[model samples]
Target: MEGRNKCAACFRQFNKMEHLVEHMRISYHSVHEPMCGICRKHCRSFESLREHLIGPLPKVDCERIFKDRGCDLCLTIFSSRNALWAHRSTCQFSRPNNAILYRMASLGIQDELRIDSSRGKAVALACKMVGGGSDGSLDLCARVCLVDEYERIIFHAYVKPTLPVTNYRYESTGIRPEFLRDAMPLKQVSRKIQDYLCNGEPIWQIRSRSGRARILVGHGLDHDLKCLELEYPPMLIRDTAKYPPLMKTSKLSNSLKYLTKAYLGYDTQTGIQDPYEDCVGTMRLYTRMRSLAHRTQDYPLATDPQNRNNYASWRQTELERMSPENLLELSRSDYYCWCLDSN
Candidate 1:
């Protein structure tokens, strides 16, 4: 009867240890074959190859895929697959909405749902704002301007700082004296922001009356809201900073300067950012992104298998050329203006 174990190289079954030893001496003697005990990579001799594989040939991790679970968003590494699964189940970073949802919403027009009671005329209008931010107190440079259903400007003002900037580091961002000109004091700014919300047509009331939805537009809107110390529902705000499809495409640079260059074909930030220009850029980017989205259908899929393979091969070649470090540096260079901190 043949033995259960067989030599992988020769595929010869042996019934007895003596027979296997004899076969190794006779048949294997003519050929010099050294095998790594761990991975079976051939080397020179048993002792040398054993030392190379087992002693110190740069330990390569060969763990099974099931053993690894890592969070892709935050790059949180996990030891075991089960542990990774458990961590992902509770990790907000792994969620679908992630960081890019805000940007996607900003590209599309917001629908104002309202019913007209007096004239009984239901009207749907595209309402949006142009806003800007600068380095000041936590709230000094942040402001939102509201536009009506007719695209008429309704109200606008700087948000008041909630905390004093006595301890904050303002010079780090290179705040200029000219940038601070025409700035309202904290008290007055707060009153203005409040009055704009309360006294003037509240956004919800306008939506109700005009049967339209109000869209908040701004650059890096989270920072704007942070400065204002106001929290609007995510759907209400259209943050051009967060728009994803436009950002995913290489046409627009991540910074306002690059975006202005691409959309308006003009280089901005030659001096300080003009609040009005910044606002206009935000609107322009939104319009351009919306137009692009309207022109395209769903993401195109490869119809032919061979074509799909070729496309994937080309993409892999391009990606491999741009290593992780290269990609990170490219991202930093593209978004240095808006990127507050480095990794």
Candidate 2:
């Protein structure tokens, strides 16, 4: 009979116990790795995980159960048939109404939103920058947009840059000289956005996640905030560009345009880029990631006291001797799983 020492992630078996120990040392298996919702086996990416679950020559047991329980969009498995049906509504989102954009534009959402972050909902932000400085080489904030989960514009405005505009980048932004003549000044606009985002939470309380501070979602938020001259709490921000699981296999950030097309199955930024549209796209991506269903972890994170020192050199010898099943049983996620956000 084959030895019981099998790697849980790759399912590789080794005759010698020492060989399995070396393999475990090299393999960086964790909950972050896309995993089979049924068998709990870790795979490299969602693409490979999809192949494992539903592709030709799939595992008989997993394929059978997944057929009924799995979500086609996120590849999550619900507890029951009823659960799967309930999840479909969330998994499948409706397209945002373009008419709302024109209506909101006329009203000028204008950063007057009252945030109640006690709701723990995330909002998406996007900005458009025009060129400043000699030869139009510097970026100056020209427009900004913020949207809620329902794709409702909470804030949208053309920002008058602090510096003189040299290039309007009209081919992309469609901003004309007249648009900024009466636009919100950058100082006033940034302050209003900052206040709205802070939502009455003090700086200290924001990081503790104990206050009503909103969780800001966006792509390249650092750049957006810099352009706007605003700062937000790190913990209260979710930038899709930096989220590890969303990155390319090469460990580089994927463009929002590419991510939208690949995951949301649509095209964006084909012509004049609308900040509202960017806001909607980023919002959809954020919510989609937050909606994933993973096994509720007990020692939820790898940093927990129970698993924190598991990798210490002193414990290495002991870990190597444990059965493969035992080692995997102790494995935990290195990062906080976004599924917890669903609660």
Candidate 3:
């Protein structure tokens, strides 16, 4: 043990070759490897190697588990039996017999609807329609419509603005106050829209009969609905403007002109977007790229409303009735399956 005459590991002395062999076996164990200094875990390879740092070594019982046809959860398919067991403990797919258990397992995942693959689903597109002047006398318009797979505009109308022009801010990017001042009021616009759609029966009735009302569509629709003073269910609204994924990316700009150019290959910067054309374009874009997601595999599409403090109290009450597992399973599948298959 004097000077450099000792073994590099364990610093044990060796008087002869056989003594050193005995020292190595006893101190390091015949099969057991040295424990890593960092994680305090056993390592099979030399510490200097990069593989030793990241790669996990096979456990002694790994082969036996597979040989005995052991639980897939305890096999060597994953890094550790513990990890595999943990995943199996929560995996809905692992339990095919128990519906309740399957549903409960799905609760850990996200809950977002997916698109169907059979027949294409319809997309609804809406947009704010404004035509006014700088003076208080201005007209605000709102358009809500349904579009088809072929990028055809089906139902379209211009609703009147609920509030006066003075109540609206023109300094915003899309607001053209001066033009709005000279335009008609929300009442006038609503009359025009009602006249157009209700001339015979309602277009909504016709579309609903033809099953076109369930189409997938898009727009900066929330503001449009507000301007129109329309109250519809959240499912009826698929506003691309509020979709976080589209907003985070550069594919669609906040401005209609930019969105048209980027998505529909049309430049609306020169003049006002025809309400019908804007609606169609937004729907086309939404239909084209609605499958993309930004989150990881296990990330929930919608957070639990019960845990959110800012949401309405009624939201929690409604959420309490929904089983998280069922929502998660629905989110994992195609969102438009029902629409496409609803013959």
Candidate 4:
């Protein structure tokens, strides 16, 4: 079978070993991998999983229910259509924002919060939490660490949980009640962090332009931002967990602990987690990625006239006419890389 260039998992035959390797990478058919909850078939990627649910030959029952309650982003099927609707607003590929903003909009504080730009240098921050959620419901923020590009700790604080504590998960959190007893309020912590992120500028202006708000480098930033009830534009966030090349073989995310050990030659979060250590590790990873040479001095911009037409509309022969480098340029990245902006 090996000499015959056969894929054992899918039983597909290939002419060359290189083609088989590419097939294995694309098929990602492993026994231990995640399987579709409906058909129980394993997928190599989320795109393939989506195809299984909605493609031309999709599973009949799964497709029917998915139309009513499926989440396009996570491929999760909610219990009800209403639940699916509620999840849709926040189920975008980017992180979710709470409804807290609607109340602020009604109060007209949205404009009040917008001010001139502050022009701050790029910095990184990381947060740690204990007792994730009440009664196994949600995670709460416990500690935060903000460091500048030079690795200087600009702000560090222990946060008091607004909700009653439930499962401390002490083995990993290493947080004690006494540590948070005298900590800062959640609102106060949020405001201070917002001010730091805003860098004396209004959030609106920072959102509109670059070089004002600092670039945030962290792992699982979506979780951290959600716990703190904070929001930053997705473009400004550099999440190592979500980066494409760093992902697992199945195109799923790899844990920060595994990434740190694999890339940095060390270990972390063995017992209790440390926000500062996480922050430093994330910043190091960010810097390393930013330093990669994509080898193009002038990369194509999204708005370029040549890029105006969607690649899908191009004729097969037209695409075939393109050079490999040109095809690579036309292709989209699996995930957004901040280094692309720098280039």
Candidate 5:
């Protein structure tokens, strides 16, 4: 079966191995794609995925096995009957009894203060932009939201733009002139956010892997920071738009809306976009990527930390001569893999 020239993710078979290689080169499939639990085929959405599983004409093999091992709540397939049975106990997502699960979580500020500060934790940030300039073509940060790994709201504020608001983009932002009228000034908002992100770290102590500072996660985070007139250590930030594995094969960034729906199995930004929801979306995405189980590597890029091997021009002939499947196996992500965060 290894010699049959089938894509491991989409399961598309090719007459020639080179065709499969080309498909992989442009498809940009990663662990983030909405995938079939059994067949491992990537689908555009959960709706399509559901259809593929049990719709009018389902995949017979997958449907048969899914009936036995699939957890209907999360649609995950377990390896054995025991595994499925074990999963059932915790698969109560539809009706979570907050009293039992969120007893400590509801403590809010008290719960947050109890967490140890010596270890680094991820938090998500999102900003709502209102239109500025005459035709409302310029973006102005009018509001922002920040949330923790548990999707708990840490900060939510309406920001008074430094520049006068020309258009509120009310249809999307749900903001009005009155909201900004008494809102926190831009400078104050920026200072407060910076302080929260820095934790207790002084300027000199701030580093890429600082536990004192929160690791910032967001989609188009630079734009959000720019609007706030704040700056953070580059190494301390994780921008979903810039993460190599999450980007398009063309190296272009996908919108948060698209990434959320494609990878998260849900729709977003369909109506008025809420900053807290955006924060949760980015947080979910970051944690999902950070949770990748790629084994620890000792070199370059997505490989071992010590190995700096890249496809140098001197190796062009060697690369060309290798079998297509081997070449595909050799190909690695150009940027740091999020799995290294665990290391």
Candidate 6:
């Protein structure tokens, strides 16, 4: 017989014993471990944590409240339907237009742009804000730190704001006018960041060669990438904010501060925001998650072999015959997870 390694709780097979051990250590499967209040199943991460409560296979009991009280922006499940109605206005923002070229034009900054192709590795990044806008609008990135998987700083810079500083958000951001006086212009920062993310390959060519683009790991990446005026394929991004298992019961995102404290057992952003600290914390979280020995078969199939009918097109009897576990196994993740590639 061929040697086999499998997780007892989830029935996920692993190719090696060490991977099974690692998964057991992190999974902590027990009656006392954190579990989906609805599913009565232990979850490996908050992404899965929320998934059990709100996603495709959510419990019927939780589904009703979730639908009436879920906040799409923050992913919080409110106490009552009225509470959700009240919070929606505060949670969402009007989507910003492509801000890349406008930022360059407003700053009138120019610099030589170059790419360094050889340096290829995953990176964790964090952005510090300058202000929250004059009338409490959108915040701006004033500083950024990019730390490699090995915890070395590859790039760190104070970025000049393209928009006039409004509220400064000093208590949290710790930014001042002096910091921006000689800081790198937004245009220059954007170019350098682009080069780093793409290595030496043309951005347009990265899609053809999947490995050419360096992976970006961060929390609240949508806001940071927006402020930087940067675009990366969703496949290359490992965002803690949007990962389903790490989210809230209502399918909204959890705050980085809360996630760090709950999962990593530490406090962060207690005072002024330091991008380097955030970078390291974010990196640690990514490493911990990527180490999980998820079921390989659960990874999205590379190609469809069966002439299978769509779920909606299937007959009721066919659906009823399959167990809930089997149905969930057939579902696909909207984005990629490194666990899918792990051996």
- Against the true structure, whose TM-score is highest? 2
lDDT of each: 0.37, 0.76, 0.39, 0.63, 0.69, 0.64
Give stretches of model 4 more than 4 Å off. Answer: 1-120, 132-137, 297-305, 310-334, 341-343
Residues 1-343 of candidate 1: C-alpha lDDT, one tens digit per residue: 1343435423432133234333332332211133332344433232343234334442344222222443432223466777777866543211112123223222321222223323211111121112233443223443334433332234333332344333222223223333333444445643444334333455456534522433455667676555554544454455655654235233242676665664455565553233434555565555433332111212122232332342233354454455433322211111111111110
Global fold similarity of model 4 (TM-score) = 0.59
Rank the candidate models, highest TM-score first.
2, 5, 6, 4, 3, 1
After superposition, the stretches of candidate 2 with alpha carbons farther than 4 Å from their true spots are 1-28, 36-41, 47-95, 99-111, 117-120, 208-210, 311-326
Model 3, 134-223: lDDT tens per residue?
Answer: 664454553344445655444443333555444343332134444344444456544443333233335556444533334334566666
For every model shown, the clashing-pair count is 7, 0, 25, 3, 9, 9
Q: lDDT of model 4 at residue 205?
A: 84
Task: Please identify model 6 stretches exceeding 4 Å from their true place.
Answer: 1-120, 132-138, 298-335, 341-343
lDDT at position 152, candidate 6: 57
Worst 10-residue lDDT window for candidate 2 reads 6-15
Off by over 4 Å in 5: 1-120, 300-305, 309-333
Model 6 lDDT per residue over 1-343, tens place: 2344324422442233334333433333432123444445665455565555677776778666667776543345777888887876654332212245224423433334334444336788889886655585667888877877866566777788898887677788666676677788877887788777888667888767757678899999988999999877777888888875677766698888877765665677766667777787777667766765555543343233331233433343565465544444454433355665334
Q: How do the residues 1-343 of candidate 4 rate in per-residue lDDT, one tens digit apiece?
A: 7755545533342133334333333432333233466766655444466677877678888899788888764576788999988977653321113135323322322121222233235567777766645365567897777766655566667788888778666677666676677777888887877877777767788889857677878888899888888888787888888875566656688887777765555677665566666776777667756754444523234434553453443354565455543443443322344556455
Off by over 4 Å in 3: 1-121, 131-139, 142-146, 157-216, 248-253, 291-343
- The lDDT leader among the candidates is 2
Pick out the ten consecutive residues of candidate 1 with the lowest summed lDDT: 334-343
TM-score, prediction 1: 0.35
Q: Model 5, range 1-343, lDDT digits (tens) per residue?
A: 7655445533443234446445555544443344688877765434456667776678999989888887654567899989999977754322112243223322221112223354347878999999888898899998887778887667777888988888988888777676666777889888877877888456457854476677899999989999999989988899999886567645688888877765675677766667777887888778767875654434524344443344445765575567754664544444565666766
Measured with C-alpha atoms, the lDDT of residue 118 in candidate 6 is 43
